[model samples]
Target chain A: MSIFKETRITRLLIISAIILIPIALSGCVSGGSMTATSWPGVTADESNLYIAFNQSVFAINQDNGKVLWRFPVEPEKNQTFFAPPVLTEEGELIVGSYNNNVYKLSASDGHVIWNFTGAKDRIIGGSVITDQIVLSPSTDNHLYALDLASGNLIWSFEANEALWAAPMVDQERVFLSSLDHFIYALDLATGKELWRQDLENAMVDTPVLAGDLLLVGTFGNELISLNANTGDLEWRFKTEGWVWSSPAVYDNNAYFGDMAGNFYIIDVASGQQIERAQMGSPIATTPAIGDNEIFIVTEQGDLYARGLDTAHPLWQIAIEGRMLSDAVLANETLFVASLDADNLVSAMNIESGNLRWQFAPEK
Target chain B: MWDTLILDPMINALLVIYDLLGNNFGLAIIVFTVIIRLITLPLSLQQQKSSMKMQDLQKTKRWKDLEKKYKDNKKKLQEEQLKIYQEIGFNPMSGCLPTLIQFPIIIGLYQAIIRTLAVTPIQLLDLSGHIYQSGFFSIPSSLLPLTSNFLWMNLGQPERFWVTLPIVGLFGIPVLTILVVISTYYQSKLTMATTPGDGEGQGAQMTKMMSLYMPLMLGYFAYTFASGLALYFVASNLLGIAQYSLIKSSKGSNIDLAPVKKSVKK
Candidate 1:
C-alpha cells in the first residue's frame, strides 16, 4: 500500500537508466572513436594509386582499380595510416602512420625499407619527399626532415601547435601552416626557422604559392596571401564561411570553396573577389584544375565540372559518398576519394563524367 | 530539431566559456557544469520536494490503515491509493517531471564537450557546422584546436598519470578512472530509492544491482574513453553531492531510502 513500494515504476526507471547511461557514455566516446581513425588519404603516380586508409596503405593499379599490394598484408589494430603517402623519386613510398612512425617502403612490392619512430605523436599530414630529404609534419608540432634513403632524422623544427598541413617545400625554403594560427618558413636543409607570421587563426591546408604570394586558406573564414619570402601578411580576403579547401592557383586567380557552399575566384595579386557562386553544397576538398575545366567535389558528394573562366557548371554529377580529400587528376581521369562508400576511391573520365572504376580492397 | 534546439547552443556556449577562460578546457567544463546546475536548481528542488512529500505520505497512519484494509485485494489497493492521492491533491508522476526535462541537458553537455575538443579531421569538420560564426553570439575561430592538454592529461585521449616508482620503472596509472568510480558509487549510493519490505523484492534487487554496477560501468568508460568525460563525471558527482546536501540541510531531514516496516504479509 506504500506509494513508494511501486515496483513497476522503479523497475522501469532502473531499466531506463541502465539503457540510457551506456547510450550517453557511448554517445560521447563514439564521436572521437569513430573519427580518430579518419577518412582515406589518396595519392597517385603514373601507373599506381596509393591509398592510406584505416589500417593499411594499398598500392592500386591505376587503370583497373585493382589493389596491387597492401602493406603488412594483415591489418593491425594499433597501426593506422591516413596521411597521403609520399612517393619518392627513387621509387620508394614514404608514408606516415597513426602509430607515430614513418616508413619507407618499396613502391613496387610494399616492403618496408626503413622505419622512423622518433616522432612522439601521430603523423597526420603527408610528407614532402625531395631527392635527399623527406619533410614530414606531425601532430606533435614538429616538422621533421629525414634522409630520403635512410629514414634517419636529419633535423626537426617545433612549432606552437599541431602541424596538420603538408609543408610546401621549394628550392631553398619550406612553407608550413599550423593549427596554432601561424604560418612558418623553414630552411630546407636544416629545418631551421626562417620567418613566421601570426595570422590569428588556424590554417588547415597546404599553402599554395601564387606568384610571390603564398595563398593560405583558414578556419578563420579568410584566405590570406602571405609574402613567400618573409612570411608577412600581404592581404586577406574575407568569405562567408571557413575556407578549409586549399586554393588552386592558376592564371593569377585563386580558386577555392567555403563551407557555406560558395565557390570563389579571387585575384591572387590584390586579394579581391573576382567571382562567387553558390555550389549548393559545402566544398571541403581542393578543386582539380584541368586544361579547360575545373573539377570540384563537395562534402555532400556532388561533383561539378565548371569552366575555368565561369562559375557556371559545365556538368554536375552526384556521387554516392562524402568527398573529403583533394581530387587527384591523372591520365585524363579524375580520382576522388570518398567516405562511407562501397568503394574507397572512384575514378571517372575527366570529360564525360563516366565512372571508370571504383576500388575497395578485396576481403 | 535536436541539433538546433539543444546541441548547437550547448557547444557554442561551452566554446565561448573556453575562449573566455583563457583556453583552459578543464576549467571551462567545471564552469559550464556549475552554470548548468544553477540554471536547473529550481527544477531539482521541486523534484526533491515531490519525492519527500510522497515518502512522508507513505509513513502516515491513514496510509498504513488503508494498506492493511486493502491487503487482500490488489485492485482495491490501487483504487484506495488513487483516492488518497486525489484527496491529498498530489501527483505521483511529479517526481519524474524534472528528470525528464533535464535529460536533454545531460545529453547536450556530453556532446558539446566531445565536439569542442575535436581530435580528428571528421570531428573538426562536424564541429564547424554547429559553431556560431556570426554576430554577437560568435565564438572566435582562433579558439579552436582548443588546447586539449589540460594539466598532464590530453582531454581528447584516455588519461593516465605516469609515475616512476622505485624498482618499477615507469608506470601509467588510471588516476582519473579511479576517481570516477569512487564518485559515481558515492552519488548512486546517495540517490538510491528505499525498498518498502525487507529488501527482497524485484525493485530492491534492481536498486542493489544499480548501486554496484553504475560505478563499474562508468569506470570502464573512464578507462577506455577520453579523460575529459571522466573529469565531467567527477565534477558532476561532487556538485550533485553538494546539491543534495543543501536540499537535505534546508529541509531538516535526510532523503534516506531506509526501510519502512511492512504492514501486509504476502
Candidate 2:
C-alpha cells in the first residue's frame, strides 16, 4: 500500500494544507480588507471642531459632539485622512490625505473648492500655512509649497528621506525636519535651500521655535536644541526612549515625553534634564501646554494633567484608546482624539480634568 | 505571539540586510532567505537523512513481501509498517520537521515584504508602529526608500503583470518564479521516497505524482504573491538542492524518484 493511496495521513495533510496555507496567504494582503477603521485627529476653532477621520474630513459642533458636516458628502474614493483638518485664515478646511491629494473645502459647508495633486506620495504631515502658501510634507520625500488661492504648485524641495514632520514656517525661511535626519531651512518663496543641517537622528516632529532656539525631538533617543538662524546644534539631551513627541515650551522649559513614557522638562539653554516624570506606557502624543497646567497622553490612552514644574500628575484619566495626535486646546476645553474607541474625539475641561463631551462616528 | 517571535525579528533582520546591501529589498530577501536556510541546515539534514533511510527501506525486497503478506489486512499492514520503521530505526516525524519549520518563516517574510513596501498612508502608519524606535539596533530612516527593483522585477508587486523594457522584461521577467518552479521540481524529485527494482510500484507512482504536484503548488504561490516572496522561494529551493546534493555526495544515490532506475537498453 502506498502512502498517498487512500491514506488518512495524506487526507489529513491535504486538508491541513488547504486550511492553513490560505489563512497564511490572507495575511499577505492584510490592509483595507477588514472593517477596521483608522483613528481620527481633531482640531478646533471657536465654535466648531474639525476632525480628520478615516476616509472623511468632518466638522462637529464644539459644544456637543454631533458631527456637523462631512466633507466629500459622499466618499467617491477609498482615501483616508489622519492629519488634523486645519482651518485657514480664510476659514477654509484644508486637509491632506492618503490618496496623495490635498483638498480645500468650505468650512461653512463641506464642499470641495480646489484639490492639489502635486505630491508624489501620500500626505502624512498636516499642511502649514505661512504668507498665503500651504506647506505640506509628504512621504514622497518632498516638501511642497502650493498657492492656497490657486491650488497651483509654488515650489517643491526634495529631501533625501521622507518628510513626516509638518513644516514650521516663518516670514523669511521655512524650517522642516525629515526622517533622513536633516533639518532644512529653506527660502520661503523659491523653495531654495538657505541652510541644511544634519541632526544625526530622524526628526519626526516639527521644530518648535522657542525664543530663536529650535527645539526638535528625534526618533533616536535625544532632544536637540539648534540655533534657528544658522542651524547649529546648541545642545542635545539624551533620553532612554525615542523622542517622537513634539515638545511645547512654557516659561523657558521644553516639555515632552519619549517612547518609554518618560516625560521631561528640559532647560532650553542648558539642555539639562531638570525634571522627569513617568507614565505607564509610551507617550505617543505631544503634550498640550495650557496657561497653568500641561495635558499629556500616553499611547496606552492614559491622559494626565500635571504642573509645569513637578514630575507628579495633578490628575490622570484613562481614555482607554490610543492617542497619537497632539491635543488641541481651544479656550478652556482640551479636545483629545481617542483612537480605537469607535473613532472617539472627546473634549475635557482643562482646568477641572472632567469630561465635557465625547464624539464617536455613528456607525 | 507572532509579532514577538517571528514578525519583529524577521522585519529587523530584513531591514538590517537592506541597510547593509544598499537598501535593495530584493537583495535583502535573497540574503535573508539564505540565512534562514543556513540556520535550519541541521533540521533539514536530519529530515533528509530520515527520508533517505525511508527510501532505502522502500527499495528492499522485504518491504514488497510485507505488502503482499498484509494485502487484505489493512490495520495489520499499518502495524507491520510501524514494526518495520521501528526495526529500521527511522523517525517519520523527522520527515515533517523541515516543512513545519518553513511555514512560519514564509508567512512572516510575506507579511514583512508587504509591510515594508508601504505605499499608502495607512500602510506607512502601520509600518511606523513596527519599526525599531530606539536602541543600538535602531535603523536610520535614511535606510528607507526601499527599492524593490532587482534584475527584472519590482519585488513589491507581482512580476507577471508589470510592463517594462519589452524583450528584457519578457525574458528576465519573473525569472525568479520560473526558478522557483524548476527548483521545487528538482528538490521534490531528490527528496521523496522510492520503491524497489521495478518502476511499476505504487510508492514510485506516488513519488512521480508528488514531483509534478510540488512544482505546480509552489508555482501557484510564485504567480500570486509579491515577487519578493517568489525570490525567497527560489532561494530556499536552490539552497535546499545544494544541501541535498552535498549530503548525497558522501554516498552516491540515484537522483530519479522512480524505482531502481534501469540503464538505457535499446
DockQ per model, Cα:
0.50, 0.20
DockQ score for candidate 2? 0.20
Instruction: Give DockQ: model 1.
Output: 0.50
Which digits, one per residue and each the tens of the lDDT, describe model 2 over residues A1-363? 334332334335545665676677665553342222344667788899998877678798988878789876766455878766778998997798877898888999888899999887778778888788888899788999999897899899999877877888878889999877899999999999989898777676788888888889876678988899999889988887778767888889888998777988889989988888777788866789877788888878888998765645688887857787789888799888876676478788887889998877765
- Encode model 1's per-residue lDDT on B1-266: one tens digit a residue: 99999889989999888888998999999899899888988888777777667666666776667677777886767776776777677777776678778877887888888888888787888889999998899888888889888889999889999999999999999999999999888877666542232356576678788888989998988898878888888888899878776765665332233232353323
Q: Chain A of candidate 1: what's the TM-score? A: 0.94
Summing lDDT over every window of 10 consecutive residues in candidate 1 chain A, give the lowest-scoring window. Answer: A28-37
Alpha-carbon runs more than 4 Å astray in model 2? A1-39, A73-78, A309-312, B1-26, B52-72, B108-231, B241-266
Chain B TM per candidate, please? 0.89, 0.77
lDDT score of residue A87 within candidate 1: 83
| Candidate 1: tens digits of C-alpha lDDT, residues A1-363 | 335445566577778878997887676554331344467888889999999987889999989998889987888778888899988887889999988999999999999999999999989889998759999999999989999878888999999898888988888889999999999998898888899999888988899887678989899899999889888889989998999878998898889999989998989899898998888888998899999899989988999998887655788888877888888998998999888877888899988899998987664
The residue-by-residue lDDT of candidate 2 on B18-124, one tens digit each, is 98988788888888888888887887787677566666666666666666776787676666666655655555665566657766776787777777775443344
Error of 2 at A199 (Å): 1.1
Off by over 4 Å in 1: A1-7, A30-37, A310-312, A361-363, B61-72, B193-198, B252-266
Measured against the true structure, the TM-scores of the candidates, in listed sequence, are: 0.93, 0.81
